[model samples]
Target chain A: MIEIHDLHYRVGAAPILSDISLSLPEGSLTALIGPNGAGKSTLLRLMARLEPLQSGRITVEGLDLATTPTDAMARTLAIMGQQNSVASRLRVRELVGFGRWPHHQGRPRAADREAVEAAIDAFGLQPFAGRFLDELSGGQVQRAFLAMTFAQDTAWMLLDEPLNNLDVAHARALMARLAQLVQDTGRSVVAVVHEVNYAAAWADHVVAMKHGRIVAQGAAEAVLTEDLLSDLYDTPVEVSRHDGRPLVLHHHSHSRIADLSRGRLPDRARLS
Target chain B: MRFAAGLGLAALLALMLVSLGVGAAEISVRQARSDAWTMLVLMESRLPRTLAVALAGAALAVSGTLIQSLVRNRFVGPDTTGTSESAALGLLAVTILAPASPIWVKMVAASFAAMAGTALFIVVIRRLPRREVMLVPIAGLVLSGVLGSIVTWIAWQADLLQYVGVWMSGEFSGVTAGRYELLWVAGLAAGLAWVGADRFAILSLGDGVATGLGLSTASVMRFGLVVVAVVSALVVTTVGMVPFLGLVVPNIVARVMGDNLRASLPVVAASGAGLLLACDIIGRLLIAPYEMPVSVILGVLGALIFLVLLYRRPAHA
Candidate 1:
């Protein structure tokens, strides 16, 4: 389990996150969902130690995040941020093979090679293993990065907006893969998901943030309610049951454009 | 890849033979009458000159590769980044301050200056927006120009312009057994770069990914800075400045072998040595008896090749 206590982050006198405390359960998939400027990504970065702790304490699996050696921390958790621009022209196999760096440093043993190949197979990258990363499509490159994080083989995985540029099919496929990994291997995953339905469909736990504070967090069914989500995003929403889970519909039936077309619009101040 | 490396090595060996035979005094090794004279020439001048050329070539290329990795820019090299010019400035300062100082002291002083100059360049470029890739080398070139003018003005004031001029243009005519040993240290720096190739390759991916992968990016970058500074300083103090060997060699090698430095570093080093040796041989043969500096030929060819690189399809695609 990951524990956070009294976390406060600020940038140049502007507070980004304030007085936050949360504990994420082990062996479960958690989704962090929030509107823009809610500090969701900053919170995840802090938990992964990508950002230095300013005033908080975080512990992962009984190891203090502030003092643990980076290599040891790497074995405990793997975080993939939203950097899609790769500078070097590396082959997919070589890029995936770097995930074993913490284990082998520079010399790769046969076991490490086996793990790399296993990761490649897991991601269905055998056909493109020898190709350079720049040669592949956007979705394929996303999968390659995902395969690298998986090849790290840590107890916890953190992904920030993994579905940024992926198509609907690819996004659904990635969510399924993450769910299967959590179920079969009992590894923990925490992802920042924008689409609430994805969280509703797959996340075992959901965390909602607003104004740098945790608005609500609980089991998926308990926290994803019609009133809470509508208030969270400042838009009216309807929640219904689908396959024994909550499905949120937030797209408005009568949009402002429709009001404008029907000659029932208010002043431009309200529209702006 | 192995076949290409083998061919390069073979060609480099042939170039070394040609370099040894094409000096000013014609002493044939096949003639038994001047055997002692031939051996003396080979030992004192020919061998050291050839070896110095190869070592300086490899060191400059590796140094350039390290800088490119640290800066994450393809076009910046030691020549353009104020490294060589700063070293020349240091050499001038030491010459003017203590005319009787030993050569080793001068080399150390030059290395310190080069480190400072390169660090300033990094700090300057770090402020610019990263997506504008062309801004980096342009900044480096401007820094080089500023440092070059300072060195020239100081040299002119101190009545040391002739010495500084020799150091500005690279040549092998004055290289002998005892005078050209500093480049062996530069060669050692290249070997160190090879040993740390994996870290450099990882570093090129950027700070966030490298740290996520558990590398101490700060320490690795510091080590790289020291390597680049020392190599550039040694080359400048020994054989003067060799332009574009660093820039051209690494790009050509990457074009053929991609940017996996561990797989391509050895080839980069060999190709650097091979290209420089070929240039030196051409300079020697072009205007026999009255030699032209290798930098002139390299400058001309490097600019042409650099234009081609700029106009070609983006290598990222």
Candidate 2:
């Protein structure tokens, strides 16, 4: 279990995350979703300890976040952020190999090397393993970074905006991988996702955040409703059943023609 | 990698031998007529000059690699960070305060000042938004400019401008066996840098990544900076100022290699030594007997390469 209680993070005078509390279950695929500026990434970074907790308590698998040794913490959790601008000259395999640093420090054993190879294969990156990161396309680079995170082989994985630069096909492939990771290895996963459909399709749990606070969190069907999403984004949203899963759809509001016939543009059509 | 390193080593040896032969006293079989005289010249000046040039080049280049990694900016090095400038200022102060102080005292003072200068750069960088990535290095260059003016003013006020000029214009003519021994410490610092290469490499990935990997970034950053300070202080005290040695050599090596410090450190050291050796040889030949300092030669060459690197592509933040 990962527990966060009364967590608050501030930058200068502005609060980035406030009064957050949650218990994340083990072996679950948890999706964090929110509109822009909802503090989703900040929340992810805090849980990963990438951002310091200003005031609160967080425990991962009975280890206090405040006092756990970094190396020990690393053995339990691995995180990949959106901005992974490491030197592009590094080979794809070498970049993936860095995931083993926490375990090996500097010296690698046979098991470590094999783990790296397995990760490379898991992402189907074998063909480009020898290629430098700069030579890969944006989506390929994203996959390579994901492979590195997986190579850590931690029980818990935190990813912030991992789907950026990935096309629909790649996104589905990654979601499938994440689902498989949860089901096969029983590793707990929390991912910040922009597209709610991806979350609706694959996530067992959904965490909705807004204005630095958690609005709701539960099973995907319970939290991802038409009323909630419309209010969450300040735009009308429609949710319908698709293969027994919620599929969200919204396009410029259903009142567009009525407003247009009234001799005025729809509210959402304003250029300003 | 082995072949390139071997080739570089071979080139360095060849340069050292040729450099050992270029001076006024022709060290040859003819000079064997007086073995004592030839041996004395070789021991007293020639060998130390070659060794000092090699050590300084290697030290400064490794220092450059560490500084660039420490600041997480490719453009930053001793020249831009005010490290060399502060070192010069410390040397100037000692020269003014104790005109007759021994070389060790001056070195101590310069090391202190250089560390202080780098600390300032770190503080400034800590406050930077980091989104405006180029601004960090530009700020470092600005800091260097400020420190340079202070050094100039102090030199001008004390009527010791010539002494300051000699310190700023690096050369090997004055290096003797005992005078350049501090670089041995600088050399050891470079070796330590290589030994701790992975720490620095991960640090270059940025604090978030390093901390996420469960590494204590603060201590590693401090250690890297200590290496940078020692290298800058020792080299400045021993050889005046060798501009762009840290910036250009490490960059060229990293371009061929990657920025993985473990893999790139020794190569950076070798490339730096080779480049400085080449520059020193050119200085000796450019106006034979008149003998230009390597700094003057490297200034023009380093500037040209730095400009090319700058115009080639946008640097990562």
Of the candidates shown, which would achieve the greatest lDDT relative to the real structure? 1
Estimate TM-scores for all models: 0.94, 0.93
Clashing pairs in 2: none
- Give lDDT tens digits, candidate 2, residues B1-317: 68977887898888888878778666772464579888788888888988999899999999999998888778877878999999999888898889799888988899889989998999998899876678888999899999989999988998988877887889998987788888888999999999889888777777777877788998998898888888888888888888988888877877777777788898898888888988998998899878989999999999999888878743442
User: How well is each residue in A1-272 modelled by candidate 2, as lDDT tens digits?
Assistant: 89999999889999989899999889999999999999999989988998777899999999898899998998899998886465536778888888899999999899999999999998899999988776778788888888888988898999999888789999989998889979988999999999999999999999999999999999999999977887788765667778899987665544753454344543432421
- lDDT of each residue in B119-229, candidate 1, tens digit only: 999999999998888899999999999999999999999888998898899888889999999899999999999988989998898776687778888899999999999
Q: After superposition, how far is residue B6 of candidate 2 from its true place, in Å?
A: 2.2
**True-structure RMSD, every candidate:** 3.9, 3.7
lDDT tens readout by residue for model 1, A87-148: 67788998888888888999999998999999898888999999988788888887888788
Q: Which ten residues in a row have the lowest lDDT in candidate 1 chain B?
A: B308-317
State the lDDT at B65 in candidate 1: 89
